[model samples]
Target: MTKPKLSTPAPVIEKVAIANRGEVAVRIVRACQELGLTSLLLHSEADRSSLAYRLADETLCIGPAEVGASYLNIEATIQGALSGGADALHPGFGFLSENADFAEACAQAGLVFVGPSPESLRLFGDKISAKDLVEKAGGPVIPGYQGQDQSLRTLLEKVEEIGYPVMVKAAAGGGGRGLKVIHRMDQAVEAIEAAQREGLSAFGSAQVFLEKYLAEAKHIEVQIFADHLGRVQHLFERECSIQRRHQKIIEEALSPSLSPTLREEITQVAVKIAEQAGYRGAGTIEFLLAPDNQFYFLEMNTRLQVEHPVTEMVLGVDLVKAQLLTAMGRSLNWQEAFHPRGHSIECRIYAEDPYRGGMPSTGVLGFCHWPQGPGRRFEVGFEKGDEITSYYDSMLAKVIVWDENRPRAIEKMKATLRDCVIFGLRTNIPFLLAMMEHPEFLSGQMTTGFVDKYFSRPLKEPSLTRSDRQLAEAVVKTLNREGLGGPRPRGPDGEAGPVPSPWGHSWRSGL
Candidate 1:
């Protein structure tokens, strides 16, 4: 299939209803403010105390705490947006961002969806269809089976044919929800079933596809933007190889693995694919770069990515604002020759226990502090006194840092992560810090298996010294005196009794 003709009329947008939550919602709200547009946050009941709820110009409770009844409920979101008098709706990644039905409903309701056309969504939403389109565009695709036969016998046969260490992915999944690597024949059934279950639960699709798993492949993606007139521009690439269970944790701009020639080749191919699909708004064409420098199309993310901040930081551009402008029928007018300035790195700060293998840490936040400094940017979603619930993603904030070079950027990110103080939750900051110091990571030669190969086991718990204990006691005393979340009397150890912190009895403050 060739690029579809562009004909959707751009309407004037005054109010943008954000059909999402967390830091991305906060991101959209701020962008709307800068563009002189009103932002309406469509949130669930559990998110009432969120920072995004507080930042948006208008707010509406779409449904209950469950995502199925709220964030993923098409009718509820549409009704909420319409009732809130929004001229447009922005699904800031995940949930309904790439849902074609949601985009069509927005158009029917006269609300401009700040994304590509519904046709484009449907085309790229399915992994099988997307791969076909990419192949039609003469792009390199990994050896995989995207055939319609989803039966167990067929999948098994295909897996045997493709050999072991194959990747099983959901046909309609993103963000690594239904992606599994089958290394052995005995693990095939369980992995495939798990992938299907996750796919059905997360994306309402159980169909899966198979791929040749490149063990040492580096995850590289090109950020592409298309105007209303079918003009597509490449904002360069992002290296997201440092991932856990296919979910990216640390992302950087201008991958350290790519040569100038390879970078140009990959980016141009990405542009070609986008133009072939007649893609509009913001989208990312992901690829897997092998050790031999050969790259293959992995997938396409048809929405603003979580790591967009690193791209924006290096390029000195605002993608959220660009999405809004595209929705308003305005041209990006990007420079033909754009030079990426400096290096930027982003670490996703999740509310989880890193020492305990990243177990989710949920509770009322006691206190939070992000050290202010130049070249450091934080996209936070919660504040002190806000509750971190189990109903949503564990991510609390994104810490991004920019510097003159990659080495400086890495050091700056390390310092920034260390300076962050989240008193309530046991975050993955320790894990991120360790990864930052890893020799493979420092050398920029790590691949998709970086986490599994080196950092798979739980971290060694650090012993608290007498001075650390003293500092903890002093901090707890201050919190008690200030009546922060009420006073916690005393425990057996008499160390201020947990203080609503996720660390339980231990009170190792800050990152």
Candidate 2:
């Protein structure tokens, strides 16, 4: 492989254009300002007044609400970058972050893409190809087929050879969009056809691959950073076993279930895979740990992950800063071997209706509130009056908590979720609350299918505990005593009628 020619490291990036919107776009902007770089934002016509657009140093309208014409349009993003005089492009997580074509386009235009090289992305973005590369690097991979013919007859033969209950996954898919579970030969044909259709529509790639499915598996991933100097380091592991329909709902660091020796073994394999791919910048190596203690390589994500904050909280490192410095050809300053000190958990709060098959919720937000206090951190995108639309992802915020142990962290998260509120749109708050209260979750007996099995019950209206109810009553009484600047007025029935308080309006309404 030919090495990239290093040009006298472009004047330390005075300005950067975030190529996506929402919470991640805001996140990149804050990171840029910390490094003394001006932040630029690219928005669609519908998001002209978004909070992120207002916070940016400058904003450019890319196109209409259709993602094809706006967020996913590589040419428009590049034009926006050049017109805004941006020296670098931060493809925040989704959309163009993992797109090799987009990354190469940025490089060819002389704009720095804040991620691994396009070659590395291409090598790992395709599941079939990535499996071969991992095996070459001495990593264990599930036995499966990577061929294209996928005819029903051929697939059945392969399934017979690999054993029953295999997973049919889109080669170019992520976020669990195009995956299906097949348990017997009779179901293989229909599963493959449906997956192919979804993959074609969603990703414009109909390629699918087969893999041996492990039941009740734990999903763990290692965070690795590689610099331009051929050095790589691992930042330990994150357990993302709590998922629903292939999407992660909660993630934690220093997996409560893994032994110390097992953790080290996984980290070493992750480092080896990174070195084999000639990887640079921040990337995640995912693995599925079976009940028997054996682990198989899942796919590699060649960009900064949404759950990266949990790792940062426990390791006391800024992964975004490291990515920026690595893009500028700087080596990591920390030691090669780092250990996590405490436990950290992150819960994703989305504007969606969990009761209605998790359909995305869209409306104008009337009130926005985030949790606070010790061990709580909220990364949000929308404020009051912001519109939640179906044009983009449903995620509105990520609430993370850190503590000295898993149980404490779990409790902190439960309280934080209760304190957060978003009015005027249906949210998954009730579902999140239920998950936190599950016995299996608290005991750390979680798996990728935990949500599917335990989340069968429909969410009911949340009830306040006795102490919370008492606090609410006291707050209501105080408000009645001080009614809107005048002496408290009694109703005809002799009861305080609809006492108003700025702080307890929603609480009193039981919303």
Among the numbered candidates, top lDDT falls to 1
Per-residue lDDT of candidate 2, residues 104-125 (tens digit): 8888777889999899989988
lDDT for 7 (candidate 1) = 33
Q: Which segments of model 1 are wrong by more than 4 Å?
A: 1-8, 473-511
Q: Which pairs of residues collide in model 2?
A: none
Model 2 alpha-carbon drift over 4 Å, by segment: 1-6, 9-11, 184-187, 461-511
User: What TM-score do all the candidates reach, one by one?
Assistant: 0.93, 0.88
Best by TM-score: 1
Q: Please report the TM-score between candidate 1 and the true structure.
A: 0.93
TM for candidate 2 is: 0.88
| Model 1: number of backbone collisions | 0
The stretch of ten residues in a row with the least summed lDDT in candidate 2 is: 484-493
Go through the candidates in order and give each one's C-alpha lDDT.
0.92, 0.84
